[model samples]
Target: MNGDNRIHLVRDEIRRVSACDHATLDAVAELLGTREINVLAGRLGMVAAHMASRAGIAEGMPPPGTFPGAGNERIDLAAQWNAVTVAGWFVRKKLTAWWWHDVLFDGVLVTYELVKAFVTAVVDDDPSHITRLTLRLRALSAGRLVIEVHDSPENAHLISAADNLISPQVEHVAHHCGRHEHQGRTVLWCELARPELSRWI
Candidate 1:
């Protein structure tokens, strides 16, 4: 088949397989008329490469070294429910299914855990006070993931103490962890470099 026709066929098959409840490597291999899992993996990797290229082309420029203000994107959660709900929403909206499959599946779980810790710290500080929780996700230049948890000025002391407790829970997964202040907000940040995702190119 022609190049365009082949791409169209592959895309259609991908969409079909993605809709399946058990969309595993074996299932994809069956749908694509291939029995070799390695071949299927290589093909999918090529597809991801092409998608990245297309994105750069569509932007009429080379792929950006980093997303604009990526390390500084913040979401403010004003209440406990808001923290949990927003964290779930961010996962669903910001991450693609392909991303979950190719990399960072466990990373999402870690992020959720941290989100819970952040929310709990704020709520425990002063249940009656209106808590403001800020969450930030950034992709560093070295391809590491950095998550920042920020609290309002009123809860600064509580957040600092809470971060000390939270750090140990996440230190096994995070390469670096620390606390600081940003624009008057108390911030706790963690940087992670997953072996599987570190070679993304």
Candidate 2:
């Protein structure tokens, strides 16, 4: 992707994150009706009765390497729905997904924070060297979802930098949450369940 396009995504992501972190029902709902917001929401595996969209290649420029890459990349930016973001949407829309609110809320939040903290502590400015931070969410099943934040194949060894990050959060939840190796990618992951999560939430 060109530097201009990457910057645009980062700016948009910053805006979306701010919006999600401080969302109001009336303010966000009207925007939800738009084709753009609906498509963005749908990209993250969120679809209401009136809207259902699948995840696809973002913005068309597939970054760089085996994944998205750019040498002139200024900063990483992407709009992703964590459990907290998802729960917020569900609550605002009054959706019937109890599992989203009850299960993954703090679980994903903690994991997300832990991994980000690792990046900050280890990389200082971030391993991306001012690239976009993109998180991918996947539902392994009705009761489990995996959150992945990838740096780059070039910084593959940095994956082990998170080796010690999980214990702090694990002491609190400990529901199959940790770092994982899948194929060639390294990911920090957390799982959420309805009944099991009640003990923590």
The most accurate candidate by TM-score is 1
Kindly list the per-residue Cα lDDT of model 2 for residues 1-201, writing each as its tens digit: 999999899778756654664447457667665775656654443212111111221322111111112011111332222333443333323213323555445544554564454455346535345333335444433334334445556444555554565556544663455555555555554433335322111
Residue-wise C-alpha lDDT for candidate 1, range 1-201, written one tens digit per residue: 899999899889878765667546556557664445666566465444434433332422222233334333457777575676676566544545324322265445555667777777778767888867777666543245566666777776666666453445566776666555445556565656546433332
TM-score of 2: 0.41
Q: Give each model a TM-score.
A: 0.52, 0.41
User: Which pairs clash in model 1?
Assistant: none
**lDDT for each of the candidates?**
0.58, 0.43
What C-alpha lDDT does candidate 1 achieve relative to the native structure?
A: 0.58
Q: How displaced is residue 4 in candidate 2, in Å? A: 58
- Candidate 2's C-alpha lDDT? 0.43
